[model samples]
Structures are given as structure tokens and as C-alpha cells.
Target: MRSAPGEFEIIRDYFADAPIGEGVVLGVGDDCALLQPPAGALLATSVDTLVADRHFPASADPAAIAARALRVNLSDLAAMNAQPLWFTLALTLPHSDAAWLQKFADGLLQTAKAYGVSLVGGDTTCGPLSITIQVTGSSVKPLRRDGARIGDAVYVSGELGAAAAALPVVLGQKLAGEPDRDAAERAYYFPEPQLATAAAIGDIASSALDISDGLLADLGHICAASGVSADIDLHALPVAPLARQLAGERALELAASGGDDYQLCFTVPQEQVATLEKLGLDAVCIGTIVEGQGEVHAWLDGERWFPEAAGYEHF
Candidate 1:
């Protein structure tokens, strides 16, 4: 009893006169959108998918879901130290709901405007709910996870584990008392991808990756990719006061293995740590890379510590 999405309706309401690129030679309503890049620019493209009951909750507001979908993709670009330029959207929905579409589109437009990116081309299909976004950017140099070197110090931007902490609250697994639940909720819903901060780090950081997974799990990617070992100091990690108070002794558990932080984690030389300190970035020297291999385990109070939970597993 639902209407199938047709190209004509989508064109008139959603795609007609859609803004594409500043240097777009061919925009949408064509076989493919054509773009012309500047001579000195290098193209960086990333694609991400958000499915209902997987990437996000079915009950979440459409505007927030749209913003988060775009933000998560943007976070990937930020990890590579690229400035976002344009994007293409592919949407699958069960039916044409005008109210929901309006909110989703408004959120998408607002997020794109905020990040200086433009919507170029895409398609809409009738199916289960899903959003696929491909964003493109330009960078002279891309920060990769494999550039970490022996003797470089590991650093993380902002506090860790708030997003994971909020998960329990959202699912009714935990009760609200202090600021922990509130902080966690904010981190989970409105993740501020560290684009400008990563750009500031530039070539200074030898290797970098965004912390979408737990700290140890995400850092393990850098370690495995770079063939190095990382030693993290539990005391050195910056845990939010609210989370620490709520978690008590379990603070380390949340910090080590909780996911959805969306912060930048990178490795910098010991000598450059001082320079980075002056930049007003709340970067913490939580660990150091050494001439070894494998994922990072922590040392707290001179005892080997392992978190009970791992990062988010898509399986």
C-alpha cells in the first residue's frame, strides 16, 4: 500500500537544481557528475553506509541521523587530513514520507554547508532504510595510519569513552545520576570530527587514525599497520570527570575499550610534543611506540590491565 519512488518526483522535489561543485563541468541529471580539480590538489574519497538498527537506531530523529551519517564520513576524511569538497548521496527508503524527507534533507544541507562541502549526484530507491554517502576532498598530503615510527609518542584529542558510556543509557541499560549520562549522550549524538585539529597537526604527526572504535582497538590498527608496539600509561589517559565519577575504578575499562569517541589519535616524535603542547590542543601523551609488534595493553599501578570489552564489532 506504499508508493514506489519514481525519478520524476525525486527530480522535482529533491534533485532539481541541486548544487554540485564550484568547478563542475557536468552536474547531476546526467550519466555522471564531472568535476575539475585544481592543478595542485590531490583527490581523497571515502564512502560510508548507515543502516537502520545497525549504524543508528530506528527511533532516532531523521535530522540527527542525517547529520551523524555525514559527520561520520567527514570524520574519515579528517583522519586523512583532507579538506572536504563535495559528496554524493544514495538513499534507500521504504516509502516517500514528505515530512521525514524534508527534515533529512534540511539536516543534510545544513551539515554540508557547515563543512563547506557540496552535494553533487546520487539516486533514491525504494527499499529498507539506508544511507550511503561518498565524500571527496583535496589534500597535498594524506595522514595515514601506517606512518607511525618507533620512539614516537602516541596522542589522543579530547576525552575518551563518553560515547560508549552513553550507549548504556540510550538502551536503558544504565540510569542517569550525574553528568556522565548527559556527556555521553552529547558525544554519541553530536560527534565533532577533528578536521581542523588534524590539519594543524599536519606532517608533524607521523601517523594518525580517528578513534571510532575503542582506544586500544583503534590504536592497534596503527600498531599493526606500522609494525610497532605501543605502551599506554593508564594514568596518562584523560578521562572526563563525569565518566570517571560514574565509572569509579571502571574508568580505565571505559577508556580502553569503549567506542564512538570520534577523536584523532596520532603519533608524534618526543621532540615535537613540546611544540604541539603550545597549540592549545588538549592532546595527551598517553603512550609511546617501541620496536616491537601487536596491540597495546595498558599498565596501571604497575599491574598489567586488560579491559573486559572490545570495540564495536559489525558482526
Candidate 2:
């Protein structure tokens, strides 16, 4: 029989030491975590769930899995230009191992503290390995998908393709110890949420989203929501150098259609490009919103192109 611990014991041992953020009026051990949203700011909430071998490899480190689970949710908040306030964790495990739980909790709480978020409340149960996190944030005026407009320039933060490049190695398809493989592993395990950039350019961004799905797919979402189209320049993508190790066009394909990048994709007016540059944001101008509805056209040397695959969708 698998060893299981009591729910309260799980909480007491693992989640008790979570940081207390400014918005947490009441924290763990309560029926409901009480949160006080900041004055003049609307609460932004997002939830993400990761199952073993689906969202992550079963062989992945527990701490890395925990961090990725929470960070994905935090990336959503960042997309809205929100400040993280609090979070609740729901955990399911085949069996409770003190060491594994402790490591997971350490990663979770440490990440929360780094983002100034508090762990408020949650539940623990015996089941398959899974984690669900609900994060609440605040924003005076969050960027929305519907806010994109024609003539807006699309921008993406950071480099893409590394996390996707690491997938083969993570699945044991590629050998470890390669230079690019190591970088891909780091990118896959520790994707940074773009909170600082989001906050800095919040007022300037017309629409914003995180690139969990491939860039083209997620960019298409903004266009669909805004009833527009996009023309992306292949030459302008901020692809990571790790992708150069790939065969011809595979790098661009990964940057276009491979998932798990978790970078921000946002739209801004051409007039605001100087303002964004002055803000010192790490980004690249990849495309422009046009009149067509929901269509994303990729261009290389003035010709239309498309990625070989679409983003991941479980169905």
C-alpha cells in the first residue's frame, strides 16, 4: 500500500511557512483565505494545473515541477500587468513522501516570496501526482485581448525556442551534457514570469498575453479576440541561440510552433515604440495587426509561410 499522510499534517508540515504578503489578511489553516485587494485595483485571478507526465516529465525534479506549476499561473497574472497578491495550492499525490513534499513546498513558497505573493489556503489529497495553483493579483487597468487594434505592432519579450528545444532531452530522446541542451534544460525548468516588463509597459500595451502555446498560435488568439490579423516577420523573431544547433528551419519552427516558452506577447502602437525603447524592456518587434480577422501570416523574404505544426492542445 502507498503511504499517505493526513491532510492537516500535510498542511502543517509543508505549507505552514509560506510568506505573508500585503494582501493576505488571513492565511493557511483557515476555511477560506481572506485577501484584501489593494484600493483602486481590480483583482486578477488565474489557475493552472499540471499533471505528471503531461505538463512535465515524470522523471523531473519535484522542486522544478512545483516551480513550473506556480510560475505558469504567475505568467498569466503578468500578462495582465498585475502584481501578485496571494495563492492557494491543491496537491494530489500517489503517496506522501516527506522529502518530496518538503522540496516541493520549499520551491513553491520561495517562488511566492520572490514575487511577493502569499500562500493563503489549500487542500491535499491522495491520488496521481498533480498540482493545481490559483493565483490572485491586482491591477489598476489590466491589458486585455480585445484591446488590440489595427496598426498596432506586436512585440514579444525574451528569446523563444529553448524550452521547446529541451523537450527531447527531457524525454530522453537526446543526450545530456550538450551546451545548448544544458541551456534548454535551464530554460525548461525555470521560465521567468515577465512581471517587471508587464508592469513597466502596462499603460502602453494595447493587448497582452503569455506565449504558453506557440507564439503564432497565441498571437492568433489576440487577433481573433480583437477581430484583426497579423503579419509576422520571420527575421525579427527573438529566437534563442540554442536553436542554432538544430537542423535547417527547425529553429524557426520551434520558435513559431513549439510550446512552453511562457514569454509575453503584446501589442503596442508604432508611436509608442520609442517610449517602450526608453523603458528598457527586452523585446522585439515581430509583426503588425492588420484588418483581416484572426489570420496570422508569417513572412520570410516577402513570401508567406506557416509553421509545420500548431501549438499543443490536449484532446
Candidate number of the best TM-score: 2
Where does candidate 2 stray beyond 4 Å?
A: 1-9, 175-181, 246-249
lDDT tens digits, residue span 115-185, model 1: 88777777788789999999998887789999888899999998876777677665556464654555655
Cα misplacement distance, residue 165 of candidate 2 (Å): 0.7
Residues 24-115, candidate 2, lDDT per residue (tens digit)?
78777666777777899899999988989888886677888888888899999999999898888888888878888888888887888788
- Looking at model 2, which ten-residue stretch has the lowest summed lDDT? 2-11
Q: What is the C-alpha lDDT of each candidate?
A: 0.81, 0.84
Whole-model lDDT, candidate 2? Answer: 0.84
Q: Residue 147 error for model 2, in Å? A: 0.9
Number of backbone-clashing residue pairs for each candidate, in the order shown: 0, 0
